[model samples]
Every structure is written in structure tokens, then in C-alpha cells.
Target: MENIISDATRRNWDRLSASTDGKLTSRANKQKSLKKIIPVEYLLDTAKIKLIEKICESYIGYSIPEIIYSIAVILLQSEGICERQSVQDILLDFQKENSIDLIQIDEAIPRFSHNEDFLGALYQSLLSEGDKNKNGSYYTPRKIVNDMLSEFDLREGQCFLDPCCGSGAFLMGVSTKDPSSLFGIEKDPIAVFIAKLNLILLYKDIDFIPQILCGDFLQDEVFFGKKSSFDYIATNPPWGNKTKIVSNLIDSKESFVHFFVKSYNLLKNRGKINFLFPESILNVKSHKVIREFIILNQDLNEIHQYSSSFTGVVTNFISMKFIKGIKTSVIKVRNKNEEFYVEYTAFQHTENKVFSLLKPQEEKIIEKVLSKSAYSLSSSEWALGIVTGNNKEKLKSSDGPNLEKIYTGKEIDKFRLREAKNYIHYDRDSFQQVARDEIYRAKEKLVYKFVSNKLMFAYDDTSSLFLNSANILIPNVPGMSTKTVLAFLNSSLYQFLYEKLFGELKVLKGNLMELPFPKIDSETNNTLTMLVEEIISEGKNNQKDIDEIIYNVYGL
Candidate 1:
């Protein structure tokens, strides 16, 4: 964790260190040193830069709280509130009570206008990426914080709390009439200290203590006296946190799920709870527990989808707002510039209670397609391609005496396969994961891309081996042949259904099993199969005919 500094943080620290030479121990020298530094882009950028540099060099081996205390003393001195002796007095009391060393900084600090959350930013920059991921603590951007805060209705004395708040981004963004109305709970002591400092800087003119505590929110029952104590709760909990939890309501070990359940338990009747989550929660099989809980218990008010918002993450994110104890039939969904309403019962009827935010016309098309279907691929045989654990050493690029052709996702297309570009020697003992011998050596099978936006299935009868990027499917439909199934899977109508119902980039088998396959007469099946063969023999010249026949057969 200590070796996972982000590139931006490293660059900022280096740039700041290169600008300073000797220690600036006097007020005159500190002010003069600041004037010689290069111009930066944002307010408080210089302060954050200097603070991070100091922490890395002087407090390298200290504990997190000890480092935080040093930062607090610097910030206090910069604000011209407390002298060095007063700071030492406060630290002596804290250390006497907690029995830990309170680090000292003798260097002179210059004053600056406290206009932003530079302390919070500095706290985030100092921590390594691995440490943040372990705690699921990525500070939310200020724009997103402000947007989520604007949706709430803050009366004069309404109570608001941000559970799992990191540096109090949401706490600082809320516009409550009274400063005391905001509360926060964080598990990291360093972040908790910075959060309290941020709120104090925000309301510097007032004289009140910030109610930010440091403890595990799930296990600590004494933080809130009773359930239903707050008017509103909003936060971006940790994602992909694999902490084990003991609960009768849900069996998921994901940290975000427990946070949601705990927050729901603490909300008052008719109170609102908003959360930002990864898009996979909508349809992933393992996450169905929380999805079912939401569908059966709470009423969803609105959902807004956003593109990738983090530095090194690629998954798209969405913000969902749920109201307690309110039952409604419709939910409002927004994506970019388009907005629409969907019946809440529509999700209830699905196999997994998936929240597929489709438009009204797309919903009608899906309903029309499923109504005429009588079969599915739930009974089919499925297998993943081989995982060699070391592909570079195991796979070969040229043909040899004992090597066989291996296909990847890049070699698969609609109704056909590109020329195989790699080969491998078959040995079950040398690989990490491989399907049964017969599944790969079947007389006929369908090979599809594992990670793709649209359906791309190819008919393969050559008994070829495939890499993990591709998967094997052998249909067991009652009356349809493998070719007929492949034609339906690669058709335009089915592609539309897959994209609308489950728009994930990865082609998961659970999602594939939920697709509908309508009953077709012998004549219709023969005609479709012939068109598929024509497209395979030629170069997709007869694809329109196959699409027309399938659409007409489904009565679309």
C-alpha cells in the first residue's frame, strides 16, 4: 500500500520539492519563498502542494493520526488563529489522553485565505491508491457533490448525515440554515480529523464544534441513539469492499450493500436515501439480493447515469434515490439528455428483478418479442475457454507438427470466423482452467465473444480450441438445430433485445439465459437456416433476409 502513489500526486510532490532549497523557519523567509514558486491552476493549490511535500519528507514513518495532527497545526497557524504555544498545549492534552506522540513542526507557516477544501485534498493526495481501495475511500469530485446536494430540500432545522463520508465533501456542500444540522461518520481517523477541520474552515466565523466521529458505522450502535433519527442520508459508500458481515437480511459480503442496509435502518419513515453505485448492480447475479430487497421494500424516485468518474476506473456509475415507506408504480430515469418513466412492476416481472432503464418504445419492443417466445437457453451446455495462466509462454504464433489452432474473441464474427492467428499444444495438466474434452471437441458448437457490446456468435464445426476471451455454447433446443440457434442469436432483432434488456459490455451467461427464443415452424426454421448458410458462404450479403424472416416470425 505504501508504494502505490498516484502519478498526479507524485508529479505534484516533485514539482513542489524542486522549487524549495533550505528550510523556511521564519515568517519573512516563508512569505518570500512563496512568492518565488511557479503559478498553479487552482486556489489553495500551493498550500496543498507544500503541505503534502512536508508530510512526505518529515513525517514519513509516523502513524496516520500523528501525521494528521501535524497537518492540523500547520492549517491552524496558516489561518492566524493559534500560536505555536497554543498548538502545543492542545497537542499535549490530546497526547496525554490518547497516549500517542503528538508530532511537532517548528517551521514557520504563512497565512492564506481559506476558500476551499485544500486540507481534504491534501489528505487524499497523501494516501496511496492501494490504501484507498482497501477502505473504498475515493473522494467524490466537488461537482458531483454539489449536484447531489442540490436535490435535497433543507429546511431550517432538518437533520442530515453522511455515513462513510471521506473528508466531508457532502457535509461541506450542503446549504443547511444552521451549521450544526450537518453530521458525518467515517472509519478512518485521519479522514475524520480532516473532515472536522474542513467544516471549521467552512464556517470560520461561527463558534461551534463539528459533529464528525471516527468509528465503524455498521458495528457502532451508540453513534445514533435510535433508528429513524435523521431526515436525510446521502453518501458514496466504498465499492468492491469484500469485508465479511453477519446479517440475516442479506448474505452479500460487499461493503456497499451492508452500508445501504444500515443506512436504510437508520432513516426515518418517509426519509430519503441517495447512493452512487457501479452500474453492475442493476443485473449482476451475485447482487440480486440487494436488488430484490430494494424492489420489495423501498420506492425508487429517480436515477441518473454518469460516465466513468474516477482516475483509473472504467466502469460507468449511476446515482439512485430511494424513499422509505412509500410505494409507487412508476420510476423516473435520466441518461444524458433523454428522460422517461418506467413501471415499477416491470422490474418485478423480470427473472432477476433487473432495473433495465429502457425507453418506452424499447420496452414495447421487448414485451412484443418476449410475448411470442416459448423457449430459452437455460438447458443448454455452456463452458468457458481455456486459461493457461501464462499465455505468452504456452501459446505459439506459427503452425507446428503437434500444435492446433486456437481462436480468441477477436476472431469471431456474425455467422463466421476469421482465420485463426494462433496455435496451442493441448495438454490438460499444463493449463489453469479448461472445459471438458468433449465440450471443445463437440461435433458442432457456437463460439461467441466473451466481452462485447453486441452479440457476435459464429458457427464452428471444426472442433477448434479457444482461449478464455471466447466461450462455447451447445444448444439443446427441442426442435431447432445448432445452426438455427446461431442464426437467431446473431440476428438484428435479438441484438436489439440484448442491448435494451442487459446493456452490459461483458456477455455474461446469466444474461444470455434470460433471452427469449420463440417457437418457429419447420418452414420458417429451414428458410432462416438457409439464409444463415448463404451469409456464411458469401460475405453477409443476405443478412437482411434473415432479419426480416425472424422479425416476421416473432410477429414484430
Candidate 2:
């Protein structure tokens, strides 16, 4: 893990060095001079960042603590002679503790974006593998933050809140000159400390003090003292978190959605929200409620959907703007490519309220189809495959006489289930009951890949068990055969509907439940069944064959 991180850091540094030709840290560029002494950049894990926070938590101290305390004194509170002396002492102590022979504040000033950026950079430097998944800590890049702040347009008195403000990046990004009323809440105290410093540096020479504190916004009612109070709320809330049954905010299990709901509630009637959220919010099944809420209640302004917005973060995200009271009259969408940003107009409908990147006509066409009858996948009995806590220890490559064949999602394609690469101990004690083991024991059922870009399912009669990545569904629909259902799932139209309506890569059971399968006559079903048999027998995708029949049956 260390080596992987080291390599990633090395590659990033090389890219930076090659682009700037060492100008970023050349002696001629005194601010960048630190690069000469320490050639490579480092990242901090949550533990190390927390350690620094502890060292700096003291009221009056030297070294790291002094820098922390001085920032809090001069920036958070009022300016005074004692504060100035303390800051000077802190800097001197920091230099001495680091074993630096000399300190050149002017020359070193250019290396950092701001005094607060020093901590921001520190957090960026010490990351280890899987640290983000464990801690949910990822610093927002300055460029993105600056662009969002500039676009949001701060006012002298309008309030600004960054609900999950990390290192106070969004709070610091606010316009310091004509600063709005500042407020932020962070769950991580280390980040809260960093934010205090960053905001102080941002608001330097300005009189307004930022009110940034540490607390879980989801769990704490104290964070929102009054309803509909804030003017603007902005932040990239913590990703990969789960909510714990908060009132109106707990619309979904996902934590970011809770932040969105809470932030929306906190805003004044006409107040605007400028936030960064995963693109999945537009179409994920679990987030459907949130999407419905947005469509029904909120008004859109602009959405900036960026591909690979953050280099290491895997999920695509959007910078969204929404107004609380008005309907979205004109919506602009800007997509970020590797080298350029392209803009598109959001497909608007007079009556429907679907916010997606699809063109107007495409949305219109889909909306027209959706206006008809559709059934939920939940109408059927669907069960999740077994979640063996430790696959490596539990799974066997060579089957025993008693062992049962097991297939994972990777082994299942559109029409065929490949040979099981591993076998499971099907003994009564082996399979832990997650949903219902009896569902897997069904003699005939359809299994589909749980996490896939497109729907991929196959009819199974072997009563074989599968791992968690593959899920089983027994249809409850009266006439739709397993073959016909599989045909619809693999069809292009279904793919388009799933992608646009529910944008999650993971094909959840909820997404299936809401799908509208066109009712077909017995004759049409026979033809589809025949085609499905041919495709499965031949072990090929026969997508066009299935789609042509299905589309004609639907009279599209």
C-alpha cells in the first residue's frame, strides 16, 4: 500500500514538475523553494492528521501547537499585540523544531496558496491505501473550490454554510473581501482546526469572523437553530456514509442524501444551494426518493457534470445549483472532459420533472413511454446472493463431493451463466442468512449481475447458489416468462431507460421493481422464448434479435 501511494505521488510530482519545468519550486521562485529541499510530495492519513490536531489543540504553545493557536487567536477572534507576538513566536518555534537553519517568510510565501493551505497540503500528502474508504477524507482541490465560490457570488450579509466542510476549503473559498455571513460544521476536529486557520487567512484584513465548528451535522439538531435560515449552502459532503434515522433528512440510507435534505431544509425559501455531489444522485435507486423530492420541490439553475473531477476519486460528481422556491426555467449543463469543458442545455419538459444530461427530445421520448403502465421489480420475489464474510478463506477451487457450485456476478453474462470458478460449502452452517437462503434454494429462478453498467441476467434451473455480486429473482408477473424477462433486460431500450432513469451502475432490486415490462401475447412470448433459447444455447449476446422483437411487440 505504501509503495502504491509512493508511486502515485511520484507520478503526480513528475507530471507537475514536467509541466512547470521546476518553476514551481526554483530558488528564483522562493515560495516553491521547499521543493528543492523535499523533492516529493506526501499525503497524510486520518490518524496522522488527527495527531497533528492533538499537538496543536493547546491554547498557547510553540511549534505546531503555536501555529494552530496563533491562527485561532488572530483570525478567529480579534487582532491584538499579544496575538501578533504569539504568531511570531509560533513561526520561530516551528522553524526551530523542524531543524531549519534559517526562516524566510517572504521567500516561502509563494509555495503555499495561503497560510491555511499549508494544512490543506499536509492532509493531501500522507494518504495511505483505503484510507479514504475508511475515513471519508478527501480534500477538495483549490481550482474546483475557487470556481464554485466565484460562480456562487457571495454577498455582504447573505449567509454561507459548508455542512461537511473539510479543512474549511469551501468556507475559505468564499469571497473574503465582500464576505457573506460564514458558518460551517465539520465532523473531523482536525479538519475543523484546519478550517479555522484557512478562514482566518482568507479573511485576513477583513473584519468578519467565520463560525466554523466540529459536529456531525446529521445527528445534531443544534446545527440548525432556525428553519429556513441560511442563504447559501455549499460543500462536498462526506462520501460513502450512512444516515442513522434522522427525521426528514433520512429519506435514503446513503449519508450524502441526508446532507442534501438537511441543507435544503436549512435554506431560506428562495435561498440557493451550490454543492458537489456524486452523479449517482441523479439516478440511483436508493436516491429515487431524493430525486423525486428535488423534482417536485426544488428548481434547478445549472449543473456542472465533470468526468474525473478529482484524479483519485473513482465516482463521477456534479457541481449543482438549485433554487428552493422557483421552477427551473433555463438549465445549463457543463460537462468537463480531460482537456476541455463542453456545455449542453438540460432537456426541459413542460410537465415532467426529470433532471438528466439527456437531450430534450430523448427525455421527451422516454417520458412518453414512462407515461404508460410500469411495474416494480419488487412485485417479484428477489433475493441477494450469499455474502461470505471472507471469500478467500471460505471459497474452494476444487470441489469436494459435498460442495456446491457457486457463481459470482463476473461469471454471469446477458444470456448465459458461465462455469462456476469456485464452490461453496452448502452445509446448513456454512451459509450465513442475509436475506433468505430459501430464495437461492429455488429450483428455477433468474439471476442477474448486481453491479453492472447494463442489465445482465440469465435463467437458472440448476438451483445453484451464487455469491453476493449476483442476485436471484423469481418473477411474480403472470405471463412474462423468465426468457422474455431476460430478453427485455438485455434489450437496448431497457438499457437506455435504466441508464437515464436510474443512473446507478449497480442494478439494485428497487430499479428492477420499477421497470415497466410491456405485456406480450403468448405467440409473441413464444417467439421471444425461442430467440432467448437460441442465444443461450449458442452462448452469444443476440441483443439485436431480442430488441427487434421486443420493440415491434411494444409498437415502438
Candidate 3:
């Protein structure tokens, strides 16, 4: 009997692990394929989604929230924790207006019932991407929840809260000795109901109610007088939400900024705040206000950057932790492959208070480069390329009457401009966004790619017009000629400096003004000009000699 039982158990495990192709899969590959647990995978599957959508279509009069409420009712009933009437009474606390008939899907209960936040997952999946982006609602994966929770050193009896909780993922991950200690505030009412239900299922034996509120964290009355209440706060605040809330703490339009400033107010002394944010929070110019607030106000503890992103979001993200106290002098940073520390003072020196995660050697190099700087491009004249609102109608590949060649970023190579491929009529009034006539018709100006990871400037004397992808820079350096300044801008040394200092893909005029221009003698300037002219006249990138000269000027 023992031998038979062992064989049967082995066969059952094999069956469970086999793929649709009848091949045994590795555990890692299987887990990766699922991306989530079994219950979540079931909800995300195509057949189940179609069934839910079909039911919604048939019940045309019912709304999505009402359908989701009915599903939650059935989920609770299947758990045997509460009867249908009891579940309905629990949902009433959320003030839901209507609910659909559960009897319509009576036979499908087994397929939908699971030990998970099934209703929340269904509602999120059903929502359009446009709506989700508008609200900045992206459900955090369980793996990320577990990873972020591991950072917090929790103690018994400490209260935890997730300010922008979506279906209680962070709250669910909080390992509190008392379930009631896990608190959350979410704006979505259906999500609030599901969060409470999930907590109740997790702690079925407990006799306490879950303190999950359904209201905006920024404008709700519940958060107005709740300063210094929570021992810990962890959340993924809405990204790029444009809802304006009046606060003098941080001046920004993004919703995440508003949520962050408010969360700081609600933390107890020595309490921690762990937030997952878009990578822009680290270095983007527009988000500088919050970075300043953090540097001036709180104890910035650590930053953990991740390469992975949410399902539809293209932006990479990072997680940061803060304590409610006087900020220390250094912040710990953890990347995928290494860990390091950056001085808090370094951010103060930067114009935007950007968090520059650099190695000690790289930081020293930047300091060395900036120390010998005598001038910057801030004195130069800058202009953007033309922005033809309707490019298809305005631009033509073939030439016609009054058509002029316009260069794009792809046509602007280092030290030389490639032949123009796009033709447009140079009508100043017809374009949506155009530079002044004199700027476009300059005798000699350097054009560079507006969106680039590195510098790609080309000297143009053809009085050329450029599309929006290219930008014009006419240098105003006192000691250097146009070609000499072009040499430094196109050199490899400046590329390294630009990438380390700004760390932005878009080459904005503000960032360009920060690049240091070392004062050079007339002889050195003339030598650089001759080298740049050689490369341009030959139409070849003779980068070696030109880069050497600029490297000597900066003493790199």
C-alpha cells in the first residue's frame, strides 16, 4: 500500500506540472508563464473574460459596479464564510446603488470562486486602458508586493496604511499580528468592497472589521486631521494623474505628488514610507518640487530601482523609502547588480535637486569637469525646429513650387548634416510652431537632435530649415568661434559628461545650458576650428584629433 501511494503521488505531481504540449516544464519557466498565482491566471484567461463580458452584455441595464458586486456576493457565498444576505449587508457599507441577479451565473460559481481577490481582478481587467491611465490605476503584482513588504521591519501592534491602495494589495501583504492593524484608503468603491472582503477572508476567525475606506486620499475628510497616526505607509501612488489639489508643500500638477505630500503628514515620528514611482521621480525636471521637499523635510533612507514595469506602462519604475525625521547626509541606492551610497549634498548642488546615482569615481570626474568651466551655453541663442501641426498634409517627399528642403534629427550626424530627404513649403504663417525667420535663416548655426541619449550636433551654413526633431543652437561664446564650439559639443568627452550629469533621453535647452565651456586661448580655439572644418569638409567623422583637443581643455 505504501508503494502504491508513493507511485500515485508522483504521477499526480507530474500531471499537475505538464504543459499543454504534454512536455514537463521547469519550475522557473512555469512560474514565469503564469506571472501570477493560479487564481489570478484563471481570472485573466480568455474564456473566463468572455463569459464575464457576455453576462454584462446580456444584463444591458446593469452597470459594471453592480455586476462586480453580484460577483463578489457569489464569491463570499462560495467561501461559506457568509450567506448571500450577510454578504449583501457587508457590501452596503460601501453604499453601492444596485446589484445584478446572482442566479444568472449559478452554474459558473465553481469556475469563478477562488481564494483570492477575484472580483477586484475582474473589475480591473474589464476597465479600459484609457480609463485606467486617466486615473493612474495599475494593479501591483503580488511579487512586487512581497518584495516591497520585505523592506519594512514591522513589529507587533504597529498600525500600517496604504494611502492609494488598489484592492488592498499592499495591505494584504502586511504581516500584522492583528488584522485590524492593516488599513487602506482607496477612491474606487468596488475596490474598497473587495479589499474589505479579501481581508475578512484572510482573517475569517477574527471578529474585527477591516478599516478600508472608499474616498480620495487627497480630498477626503478622513485624512484631514489624521496626522501622525500610521506607523508605516506603503503604496504605489497614481502616476501622471492631473487632478489638482491645493497644497503649498509641493507645486506640481501630477496626482502622485499630491498623494506623497499628504502621506508624509500622516506618518508617526520615525515611521517609514515606501513608495513605488515612475523613474521620472528620480531625475525629471518637472518633478523637482517633491525631490526638494524630501531633501529638506524627511529622512530619505533607500532607493531600489527595478527594470521591470507594469503590463501596459512603458515607463520603468523605482521604489524609495523615507522616514519622518531630519534627513541624513547620505542615501543608500540599490540597483539590479550593485549597491552604492550618494551624498545628500550632491542633490542640493544640482539645479533640480536630482538624485544622481553615480559611482564615486564618476562623481569625481563630473566635479573635475565642472571645476575648470568658465562659460556655458546659457548665453547662446536657441530655437526649436518647425512644428507643422499636420505633417502629412504640409510635408512632401517630392519637390514642388516654393518647396524647401527640411532636415530632421536623423539627418543631423556628428560634425556634418546629411542631405535633406523631406521637403516643405517655408510658409511662416502656415506652421503651427515655428522659430523666428532670422533664427532659421542664420548664416551659421549648429543643429542637433532634440531627442537623443548623446550629443549629435552638425554645423550647418546652408540656411536650412529643420523639422521639430532637430533644434538650432547658435553659440555666443566670447573666446570661441562657431566651429570651435561645435567641436566640443560633438566630441565623445562631452557625450560622457552629458549622459552622467543629466541622465535624460530628451535633450532640453535647460540641460544644455548646464554643460561647462572651458576658457581656451586663441591658438587652441583656432586648432579646434581647423579640426572641425577638416571633418566637415571631408564629410567624415575624424573624431580622434577633435576629441583629444577638447579632452585637454577640460583636463579629463
Candidate 4:
């Protein structure tokens, strides 16, 4: 069965690629030989487009003209074919029928040297472009595009725009819904052409070709002029620190912020903007302007949360819908489970409701606990800060004896601190000075100095502190140990509270400090502390054992 499917797929590719002369002869032969073959609809379905795109991408390369020719050739020979003809014969027939100059396609092919060069360059550019940054070193998965489209109600005649359209994936998805009204804006010239070709394949409208522009959305006067032009605007904006980009028109750190503010102006009154953005913008101190703009100007409706563990390539994205002049309900989903609904009243004011997939009765109990302890621990003096500058000078020249363990932003994975190779201890005066200046006193001292057998805690001034950025370590506290606090912080209960208060936004230092810690009895705290100690001790010898200990403790 697998072999049959494989053979069918191969035959489909050949049939799609066969020349006009070859196709006619093969179609006649197939008509004479076969009784009733499988329907094309059954064979291709929605997946056929992707398969053909991939196959052409694998063979014909990535130039816009080459891709168009390849697609044209493929579509012309939809019927079964047994033999192939020369490329010249195929090109001659295609040029005559489509009225496209064969010389233009031929010229584009050499610019790539061959088909392979073109495809490789196109793929690399799409993957490496500045706006393409979602998570570190990864592009947005196509599944996300399909899922968002499936979830939304996008019909014909409704205007659609992807402001930060990369290779026109979202626009393409929208075009599938309504080809007539779909439009996109891409800064990259190559991407713009690709998107244009992708659209032109299905819809041959000339006006649609000029819709995509190779200019910055933020600074481009052309975009600003089209105020309230679109009914729906969907985009996945860039994430992280380097998102601060220099605009061609303006020299400022806040260019992207300006771009977001301008987005409201572009939408019609009550027009919806469904965008995937970094959770940081919600609560990051530096991005307070964008946050305030959203709160004041638009109605933030729905929110879908993703985990930080899903960060490396596909970032922890929040899909938000913004409507003008309406109070919006915020829906938060964690781990593809645990949904929490909160109605945002006036700025910073929210009313909470619990949404549970299992044990509906549990919502009442969870709500009770949440209400009693709704605030963040950070609000109570627990601060948050980043470990930014590292001691590169102290790094051993060759393979010398390692001195001290160091921790960076990357080392702070999930919740707990992981051991890293690049590290330096507080030994030399110079090293101490660097450490004091860089790690300790760089921003505000969020690092907690462990008092003699007191609660081990750190201050996090940054917004992400609440969402497992800084870990609490308690020393000599009879009931509460460092591990105990870590376990509690990593709990579903804490996660629920985090989502309720922040909803796809970065968990700020103020928010983290305000979170109320459940008061466990001394005996239970001691038990949890001891258990944590044992787990950490075991973790040094066997990482698997440490995982097992965590699983057993969390009842995972």
C-alpha cells in the first residue's frame, strides 16, 4: 500500500511536469487503458498544493519566473503521462499559450546559474530575513497559518492585509479564502515577488499585483495614506531585544513601537487585527508605550498563550484580536489545556473566570484560591533583573582548570538554572569587579544575597521575572527550601495565576513580587524542602533521576 501511494505520488509529479506533446499521447493511452482511475480531488485535496509547491521547489529552483513556469507546466499536464519530452518543446508550447515571453523565463534561470541555486537562495533568504525572526533561528511553522485561518471567519469581499507579510504565507492563506480582496505588504523585494507570483497563479487580476510593496510599513507614506482601508489585518511580528530596528525615515529605538501605534489608524472602526506577537510587549518596561497605546486606543479581545519551552524556533506566541471602542474578553490557553477567561474592564482592571477542560467543579475551588491570592509575589519586593554582561575575559585560554560556574539568560531555562560551560568564579579582583559591575549592579540588584540560613530569593526588575525568569532559593528555612519554592513556582496553580493576571504578556517584576505565596504548615514545608534537596543531590549524579524526582513530586 505504501509503495502504491509512493508510485502514485511520483506519477502525479511526472504528469504535472510532462510537456504538451507528451501529455496528449499519455492522456490518449491512459483513456484507452484504464477503466476508472482515482479522482484528482481525492488524490490532491488541500495538501496537493503544498506537495506540488515542494516538488517544484525541489527541482525547478526559486526564481519567481522559474516557479511560475514550473507551476504552469505542472498544471497543464494534470492528466496521467507515461513519457517526457525535451525542455525546449515544453517551453515553446507554454510561451505560445500563456502569451508569456519564453526569453524572460530563460533569462531568470541563468541569474540562479541553475534551478538548484535559485531554490537554495530563496529558501535561505526567507529563513534568514530580519523580519523573519520569530523565535531564535526559526521561521513560523505553516501549521500555525492553517490553524489561525481555520479558526477565523474570513469570507469573500472582505479586505485583508498582512502588514509584516514574509513570503506571503498569511496572505496566501487569506487568498485561499477570498482571492479578490487579499493584499499584502513585504519589505523584502524577493519575498514581495514570490508572494505576487503565489497570488497570480490562482487569480490573474492586474490590480492585485501592485498591492504588495517593497517598503517599510512604519515609515512608508503609501501605507499611512491607506487609513481604515482593511477590514482584517493579520501578521506575526518579530520578537526579542533586537526588534528595535532603525527606520529609513527616522533614527530612533522606538520605530517598531510607532509601527504598532500606526496599525490602529490603518484599521476601520471596529476592524479586527489578529496578530501573533511576543509576550514581552504586554508587560516589558521599555515597551510600555506600545502597551499604553493598545489599552487606550483599541479593545484587546482574545489571547492564546504558548509555552517558553516551545521557544527556540517557534517562539511563545500570543494571538490577539483587537477591535476598536469595545471592552474585550481575554481568553488564555496554557499547555493546550487550562483555559482562563477574564474580562478587561478599564485599564489594568480585570474580572476573572476559570475555564477547566476536566473536572468542571474544580473551577469554583480554583477561583476561590485565586481571588484570595490574586497578586504577584514581585509586587511584594521580589524584584527581577537580567544577567546580561558575561565575564568573557575570565574564560580559560585553552583547556585549563575551570574555576567558577556562571549563569546567563540562556542558562535560565524553563524555571531552574542549568549549568553552562562558559563561566568564571569570583576569584581575582578584576573578575570580582566585572561580576559586581555587570551581573550584580548592572541594572538594579535583582540577585538575592542569601542571608545566613534565610529564604533564598532574587529580585527581578524585568517583566519576564514572574514567568520563571528568576528562581527563589531559601536557605535554612525549616519548612521552605529553595527546591520547595521552585516546585511551587513551577506548579499549575502558579501558572494559572500568572495567566490570569498577565494573559500572554510578560510577567513583570512588580507582578511577580505581588503574587501571594500559599502558606503551608511548617511540617509540609520541611518535607517539601527535604524532598527538593534530595532531588537536586540526585540530579548531580543522574539527570534522569532528577527528572523522575520532579515527576514524582509534581505527580506528572
For candidate 4, lDDT tens digit of each residue in 290-396?
66566555377666665421212222356666776665544333336566554333135222111222223434434455444433343222322223234455553
Candidate 1 residue pairs that clash = none
Clashes of 2: 16
Instruction: Indicate the TM-score of model 2.
Output: 0.68
lDDT of 1 by residue, 273-332 (tens): 888888888877678888888888848888878643443232567888888888877788
lDDT of 2 by residue, 1-556 (tens): 2232344344544543422222223223222222211112222243433434343343122343334433444333343322444345544544455553331111112222452365654443433324444455667766677767775666666788888987777877776455436788888765676675565556555544457667988888786455337878888877775335456655577777788888888888888887788877765545667666765664866778764334334466788788888776556677644222111223222112235566565665566556554554567888888877888988999999788899999899777898889987876456565556678778778999877878888888887888888888988665777788878887888888877765666887866777776666898888888888888787666678788886676557
After superposing all C-alphas onto the true structure, candidate 4 shows an RMSD in angstroms of 14.4
Worst 10 residues of 4 by lDDT: 108-117
Tell me how candidate 1 scores on lDDT: 0.74
User: How many angstroms is residue 247 displaced in model 1 relative to the true structure, after the best TM-score fit?
Assistant: 3.7
lDDT of 4 at 239: 46
Cand. 3 TM to true fold? 0.84
Model 1 spans > 4 angstroms off: 1-67, 77-115, 224-228, 312-314, 387-396, 400-403, 424-437
Among these predictions, the greatest lDDT belongs to 3
Lowest-sum lDDT 10-residue window in model 2? 103-112
lDDT of 3 by residue, 237-272 (tens): 988775667666568887888888888888888988
